[model samples]
Target: MPISTYQVKSFAFVVREGSISGAARRLGVSQSAVSQHISNLEATMGAQVLIRGRDGVALTPVGQDLFQLADEYASLDQRIEERLRGHAALDRGHLTIIANAPQPALSLIARYADGYPNVSIDFTLFDWSSAMQRLQERRVDIAVITEPAASRELYIRPITQSRYVCYARRDDDFAQRPVVHLRDVADRTLILPEPGSLTQRVVSKALADHGVVPRRLVTMTSFPVMKEAILEGVGVGLFLSASSVSERSLCEVAVPELDQVFTTCAVVPKHKLGLRVIKSFLDVLADSRA
Candidate 1:
């Protein structure tokens, strides 16, 4: 008899998650059950597919060969189930999405919920690395990420491009200007996003290129905190245009040297393209673009 497809699926999840417990959580099955599936698969193949170690499970050379095949089988099974439910009115299925920036994702979510009232969305706010990790682990069905590093496992669709701008409280002197340069704020305190963020990368590079340095720098990890700091007359801060365009009390100033336009993309597992829920969200995204 051939190895069971269910067993293959369990094995695939283990490969993706790097631990049996993680795979069990993803499949909503017992740890013993997952272990049993792997044992059965190994017995059927007459090979030890996984080598358990202190760090986590590692695929044996044989296991590596089977991994891709198992993933393809799982993808085909998902597609078949989705097709069987064909045109079921987009009334069910929950989407797990991870996003780095909230603006475009929030906009997309609002519109998607409005059109498909029955579909549920679970959104997680994460940094770019965390978001990419979730996608690679198959924990999230979709990801809205900014400046994602190149990867072959993900299918990326460019959604939006955002430019950096400066925002300051209305009473601040820089608020009177239509544009702000890094050199102009050398003496003033500058509020900026935390290190390693896309916004920070763009802003820092521009300042370096122009050889301008701020006298004081306040680094914030959260956008709301940065915004609040700016609102309270803390300091002028760099922000993406999408985030600052609607601010009532903050003046927007263009940063010409920081002209880097960051592109945010919708990312999904390469094999999950045909899933109904993924298709539904992408449809909403495309419609929004139109």
Candidate 2:
């Protein structure tokens, strides 16, 4: 027998979440039920889909192949639902956005909702890793991410550039420093997003290139949290450079010879542009400020 769509969904969620418990929470199902579905899927496919351990679950090579298939299956399912709706329903519709919370993407979503108030919109925020999971699962239409999308499998496109700027408290003497080096911030505490976050990863690499890693690191989920901490004298750190005064109060310090550039992206399946709604959002994104 062929594996069912639900089983595929269960499998993909399990793989992305890295544990049966996490998958169950996402799917709104019980852990045993998720495991049973995966078991049936693996049996029907004649492959050991998942390797279970104390660390959690990981997909076998064969399971990875199915993961791609599962993504396609989800895309098709969504397209079918959209197509089945009437003309009027099509004209006024709902769009689900999944991306890093508190970024300009949220601003895009807010503007879209304001313009099309009658058309319902659901915005889902996820950290970089979970956003990838949502995009692959077709749970979201597009992801506005800070991470570069280059896997080819995920269809990464760079819509625009968002630079990384160093900022500190207004009265902090560090801001007065002429040229900031990783050496300067070496012993200072740093406010940053989690390791899985794209911005943090890029900064981490930049630090590694300079042979400097801070001993004190604070990890949070969003920029606002990190920014708040920075302003509160918790730590001095770098964040995405934007034109907003509220987001940028301190000065943009020049780091000592490193690639501090970040690209804000609209990530989706290659064929996602087939829909007018998806394409329209992308167009809006391109026209908007950096």
Q: Please report the candidate that would top TM-score against the real structure.
A: 1
* TM-score for each model: 0.77, 0.67
lDDT of 1 by residue, 1-290 (tens): 58888899999888867789977976789999999999999999999999988887988999988987887777788678768887568866667787876778889999999988987777877766667766765656788888777789888999988888888888888888878888987998888878767777777887888888999999987567788898998888987777523678977788877777788899988888888878889999999999
Q: Tell me the spans in candidate 1 whose CA falls farther than 4 Å from its real position.
A: 1-3, 11-71, 132-139, 149-153
**The best candidate in terms of lDDT:** 1
Total clashes in model 2, counting residue pairs 3 or more apart in sequence or in different chains: 0
